[model samples]
Target chain A: MSDHHKETFISKYVFSLDHKMIAKQFLITGMFMGIIGMLMSIMFRLQLSNPGESFAVLEWFLGSKWAPGGILDPNMYLSLVTMHGTILVFWVLTAGLTGTFANFLIPLQIGARDMASGFMNMLSYWFFFAATIILLCSLFVETGPASAGWTIYPPLSALPQAIPGSGLGQDLWLVSIALFIVSSLLGGLNYIVTILNLRTKGMSMSRLPLTMWAILITAILGVLSFPVLLAAALLLIFDRSFGTSFYLSDIIIGGEALHHTGGSPVLFEHLFWFLGHPEVYIILLPSLGIVSEVMSVNTRKPIFGYKAMVGAMLAIAFLSFIVWGHHMFITGMDPFLGSVFTFTTLLIAIPSAVKVFNYLATLWKGSIRFTPAMLFTIGFVSTFITGGLTGLILGDSALDINVHDTYFVVGHFHIVMGLSAIYGMFSGVYHWFPKMYGRMMNKKLGYLHFWVTFIAAYGVFFPMHFLGLAGLPRRYYTNSAFPMFDNLTDINSIITFFAIVGGLVQLVFVFNFFYSIFKGTKASENPWESNTLEWTTPVERIHGNWPGEIPTVHRWPYDYSKPGADKDFVMQTEPLKEGKTEH
Target chain B: MSTSKNNTSKQLLWIAMAGIFMFFAGLTSAVIVRSAEHGWDSIDMPIWFWYSTAAIILSSLLLIIAKWQVKKGNSPSIYVLGALALGLFFGYCQVKGWDQLTAMGMYFVGEGSNPSSSFLYVITFAHLVHVIGGLVALIITSVKSLQSKYTKDNYLGIELVSIYWHFLDVLWVYLFVFLLYSVK
Candidate 1:
């Protein structure tokens, strides 16, 4: 209700209640976390490629304790791997992608002044910040960060005796995750409510941008699924701290009989993957949303098959819940149940194929602008296809048993979920940089960032598939144990080279992002000439998005290249010409 | 800021309730699966649990009456306080129930514990934690009603708290039946 107000620096920037400011907060924090995650990956990549070799950088970053004699300790290697996955998946992709875009676009695109409860949105970012602090603080603990992989499966994650990282680091990991879940739930609730209840006049659910639909569904998925992760993590906490055996059973750690019995780790697996599988979509759907909007704008065409895209995303979200069992197939589940999981898992391919076809069809013969955002959108599709194909192989229970935790699985997820989502985030940052910062990022730097990342991403992950097929299990400190795997050493070295290149290329983006905020070219009101409500607002940031009255949406967001339209793109606020039916 | 005629807070509460439902759904499913495993010792439902269940049910009834009073343009502070009292009573009974289980040699963890008893303690404790949240909302609502912050036409606060309290009440009923059926 209070749109116009004089503000101090603290109210405006630090603890702002404005959704746009909050979105920027999420973005900066996510990028900070992303750099840390990327650095961790490069550290482990070096260790993996050049086993037993000393790296001065590792000692510099990790200090002499974890990297004595400049070589990474075996336990610390697992910590790097674990924190890398945790940070990238949860902090960078899930929180960063949805947290940034959803907050920025939901109000502006939907014609609202702010989130339903601006205070809650601020709390969401602060909670995420707190969670980030705790998780980062975990790395400095005496033992190490949680190292039982990001999955944090127990017996390993449960007992400090099993792994040194399990002691305080795992406890902090659970607490941080619990707070992160709360932050996401708070943000998710606001997203769902604002999108549903705050749309301007004439903006029906069907007429809203695909980004809104994707984000709304993504928020819903987070709401339903993340609590299960909270549940799983809580039980794991009890197992670790309270001497409960929710996951641990019949243990003989250090040649001593434990009092715990009857608890099954499979129960933990069931609960974890329930959230874990949906968590993948929670990371990807926002990107899918952003890509749809970016492709529609850059290609100068209405997104093809809008209804089908909505239906397909819904289908994917629904299937995501059922298909989580595919991740646990090798846990000795019944063959019948595994078959059911396999069937459900592959059914996702249908909707996924529909989405891919829609993106291709949208691009077919359209006047495509080869902007940096468009390049990453195209890259996202490429990696989504490349990574999704391997999913078919991994989804089968019989086939998965052979390579469940191998480098193939690693390659598969990194390409599909990791690369694809990161590309979507980059696409979003480039496309909406003007709206977020009121300035343009350097196009040359953007192009350089996209090209190097694209090549290095494929270079890094594509070879891991072959190594996985060759039976190189993932998360190994060194594959120097068996001479049978000796021949794959060169490929690991190649992958590591690409990995380092990819990790470094992100700096081009970081520099472009920060530099453009202050010194880059001042943006026009609508640089992309997009047909969305967000582009209708002034370039300067304001508490309420629009200066005067919020414009009422008159048509769908995608109205590019309509016949008889004077311009190629039509803003959603424009009245249709007489007898011009809305799309 | 929003011009639409939608009840956003209600929608948010319902969505949050769905998430909370999933949370308990996860815990209950774990209970069923773990009960089928070896070395699970089934424990009887603690006597105080039934009393706590009744307290929460009656607490919901008081909130219903409070809502009715608001609709009639009367102060609902007394009924709201009644609901808060019963909410506190429900929490007390839950602790007593856990105490009763300890007396029965059923423990949450450590020596002489079983997974069945652990699930019981954790699920009920989690529910009680939520009940405490509901009690906090109840306190705020009763205080606001005393200050006449709500009226016949303006009772979103009362309505929201009622919805959440009823959901928790219903949730406890579901858990009670589920624990009765599965925890044995």
Candidate 2:
């Protein structure tokens, strides 16, 4: 095939090795998966709101067999909750958010043409796609999806007869997670090598954008952490299929003694949470980095304390590894280790506080654009703050005991990980929509998307704090078993109503995402007016990022509103002005 | 740029080699931890396994010599023979190791002995499985040497294969020492 013809639809769109196309694929798939996860949460919310009410909606969607006469089955509720959390957290957040942005931005922002291994980059997405399919397949299993919690804690997960969902659905869950971990490993390896080896001429590590720093450290965490999860999955597989008890012992299944003689479930928790804790930041720091990039540009001010911002990020990443025990304080862990974990966990707040302060400080007394991208950045910082402060509450060993499995924990994490990351995803879509699609998203719909989502998200989660304070436990199919929980039904109903609206508000954003791709206003070449190198390239993305010899970097990416600069911002590849510090 | 290109490729191969090494190291750590738990089982070390370990060490020597012959611009007929002998030696050692485990009543994918022993066999066998890929590379490197694709200044291809082969040798030694000291 001629070079021109060789670049046909199959090569360019489907099997294309360009990182940008791959990133687009990740974004689109993540949105699709995110909708599924969000819709499940809304469905569960409805059930929680009106327990013992008609199961008509679920039955209509899940079929009469699943709903069982318009009443949501307890097993189905647990299954949906498990799969919902699984998809949003792992499938959407880690792979979709981190994988896409890391692939696209790492090479571009770091000044490489493409990933270190473009073929492997393509394989990484396909593997993630396959894993997503396997996870979706669990929803169709006859016995139902994995109901053993998202953590898949054993004894519950290990015994075949522990719950009906454990029969085939838990098996599928393990297989899906194992596959996802492999996909993550492959992707992580490429990110590490590309950033380490493929930087553009003159783009040193210190001069790199904070986004690159976040991705680099996050990739390192994935590399060091994911294998432990693979190990955990393999052991669980051995227990499930091969009858080896690496993670189970002394459990009676259906009142019969299990063959598993001597194993520790705590070991599995240790391994799972080793990957699990870093995973929270793995989903978080990249979004934080994006907000940093967007905020500085929109404000047209040099990011306040660039060094301190990067330092806080590094501090957060370093501290993320040790706080796994906070998740397990109520898992009956040794009380002494709780202090160790609580201290590390709460210490995370200091750096996190520094980041939030830096963002607000950047916005302080500066020219700030309320563009949808900027709006989402502000939304992220807002949610990040509201969500992050309560983390200190749950981060405390004593306070966590009161609210461990309560909706407080749910509200805290959802605000931080859920809303914060999704806002990050949206901010990127609006900020780089011009670059990615060569068109601008409709600002009217974009703002509407921002306001509705912002309000509905708070409206949904804020009541959750009340329910938590009212001592409502999470993962309960119906809390009617306890008479004391009856008073909180009003709060559950209010939150559920808000959750449905929140779920629906995302439709506006989704419509904008697709509609804007082909039909929105034509974007200026540098729509966000940022100093990042990506804007220096052609609007029409090509296989090699630049058309000629690579552009050389001459300044830092966050150079906004510097003294004696002709423009408020400076392009990374521009020659330095006469007499000034580079930054 | 061209020379560094090949070295970068060599560096990539090194990273991949390190990746494979990490898998084995994790497996060994699992083995140590799993066996220390309750209901532990210990099995006698197989006798022929010692001989296989010795044979693999000797094969590393032959691989080095084979690479050296290609470097010296000599006809590699002797090196080819030595490499073939070493490849066969390594494969033979792997089978004998399995057989010796069988003779000692340890089995992978079977009921006899604890799963810990099965894990030992699996980890070692898995490492050997990856070594087969390396062995194939050595064969291709031997053949490429015959075609004069490498010279003293541009011998990164041969050098990389030899380095990976040596790593496998060292990795196997580490596994052996670990199994020897930790299992009993």
Candidate 3:
């Protein structure tokens, strides 16, 4: 509105106030980091499966320090694993997933002109970019990236000489994390304020889409939890730089006694897990919400229980905070308290069960249209169920003692957080690709990508469950080192085979992504005959979303197959009478 | 919606402020709990901290008076200068308190002594760091007032800055009293 039309390149892309442009920036950045994180995993998997084997490409990539004569060094292996976890969790999953979708959808779906504070929104993206730069710079440091692990456990992280990565790498890791926390806080504040204050005339809280609900609650979780991580990181920085003992004690760095005393690493574990476990849910809930919207529209039916779905999301979020102790059950905590944590963790299954059943019920006996987005939604539900069943096993204290650091834990999270959330991301991209690009993605190519990814994801992670059950520990660089793991060698190799295929299948997505951007078939305004308000906007991207006036919400987002509606699905802006509004 | 944007923006600003307050709140909790633990040794605190608390409280009153003077077109520079002096005095008081602890032979990460003294130092130092940020904001407001950038009709910046300043003023007093009365 204020002479934004003739902006320069830097103002247009780098520091754009346009929400869609901001979303595009986040998407591209996230994809770049995702490629990095995924490639790191593949490299590690090669080491895990082959065990001491290397290629010329490996040497060319690593140089002499990490791969001497094409052989993988142990410290480099650990550092790569650490960096993989760091990039995927912070930059890719949290920032990429929430950052991209929240920027695009918050203003559009809520029918506002833009976010509540445009300056803050732009600041959030720039802070995230700065954090990404700091993290990448730390990799070029002489000591390598943080190798104390992504959690950066103390005693090792507290004392400088405990490991090579703890020297400069750990310091850089904390700095990156601190910057990232600031970025998330800024974005979270904007999201919450916009949702609370800037909804259009008739968009009641209950009438909002599931995506808005997830974003709002997820922002709340970010607001309350990220600051705690900031506090922990600050204390850790003090321990590292300023000589505080908040989480350091009984230490000997280079065989010299540390000046620290009476500090408990368990306290650090408590603080870290306080943010850590809820962070897992924070990364997944957006995907789950996206799946709901996609599924309802694709199935040509209303979501089975709209109020119940919102309730489940809220319940999951609240339970997420109180159950952070699940991650600390094996960290020398009281066994009695483990029972309490296990109880709360298992109680989460109730709301999760409600969501699962609601999805199934909505898909029951409906004229289901299996679009690219629909395929991803179904993939999410399947993987969520498979991953969730294992969570029950891990949540039990007696069982957890055996599987705490086993490959079983890896399998559980990859299926849930890794595969399921990735599916959610893909579903969103496919669903909104038309709205975003004014074009349609190739349906045949999308189906191919989905099936290969879905089958291969399960093929890759499911065998790790059997390996964990066979008493194999995780984070071991080589499986052949222990004769006890010899039988599991075949299983690990099989998983790698699937993983390589799955990783390669992503190339199809890469091709589709670039090809569709410029050459895909042009689409109509509402390409997918869905009932959400986003489809009602123009096909081409507009500066502030709608053409002139914002739309007024009249019903809940899912209004498919109503008794007297003209079409199978009805737009949210279509006014309905009082008694007819009940689902 | 336009009608309530101001209120909502203020609410959001408070939410951000609440995050900052809760961060410090967690630190205070850690300090209190650590002192109650075994092996904590108490250190001698300065008398100047109590005097600084009183100074900050007086500054809060002066800040309120300046807010009133904005509408009345009254001479508020004296109160503004008074609040700045008190805030500086508070910072100087903290530095002197650190010296007092040093003179008493307490050290951060000290060898073979109670760690409670170190906790005291860290708590005070962390709070002082944040207080310095608040002081800088107040200083900017003072500069803008001197240049006549604010008036009764458009003093939202002054109002918000003073509100934050007063919040920090009361926060420091509470921490001072809590530390003196109950710490160690």
| Clash counts for the predictions, in order | 0, 1, 0
Model 2 Cα lDDT, one tens digit per residue, A1-583: 0111247788788877888889988888888899998888888887898887886778888888778777788888998899899989997889889987898888778877788788888998888888888888889989999998898988778877888888899988887787787778778878878887788898988888888888888887787777767767777777778776666667775688776765678777877887789899899988988888888899998888888988998898889877888988987767889999999999998999899889999999879988899999999999999999899899999999998899998898999998999899788778888888889989999999899899989998888888898898899999878999999888888888888887887899889889988898888878778898888778877777777777899888888888777888889988886775676
Interface RMSD of each: 1.0, 3.1, 2.3
lDDT of the candidates, in the order given: 0.93, 0.81, 0.82
How high is each candidate's TM-score? 0.99, 0.92, 0.94
- What is the Å distance of residue A333 in model 2 from its true position? 3.2
TM-score (0 to 1) for chain A, all models? 0.99, 0.97, 0.97
TM-score, chain A only, candidate 2, equals 0.97
Tens-digit lDDT track of model 3 for A209-255: 89999888888888878877777677777778877777777777568
* B34-96: candidate 2 lDDT, tens digit per residue: 676776677666665677677678867876776677677665546655665676677787788
How many clashes show up in model 2? 1
- What ordering of candidates by DockQ runs from best to worst? 1, 3, 2
Task: List, residue by residue over A1-583, the lDDT tens digit for candidate 1.
Answer: 5665788999999999999999999999999999999999999999889999999999999999999988999999999999999999999999999999999999999999999999999999999999999999999999989899999998889887788888888889988999999999999999999999988988999998999999999999999999898898889888888889999888997789988788999999999999999999999999999999999999999999999999999999999999888988888899999999999999999999999999999999999999999999999999999999999999999999999889999999999999999999999999999999999999999999999999999999999999999999999999999898999999999999999998888988998999999999999999998999999888888899888888988899899998888999999999888887887
Please give me the DockQ of candidate 1 compared with the native complex. 0.82
Q: Ten consecutive residues with minimal summed lDDT in candidate 2 chain A?
A: A1-10
User: Which candidate should be chosen as best, given lDDT against the real structure?
Assistant: 1
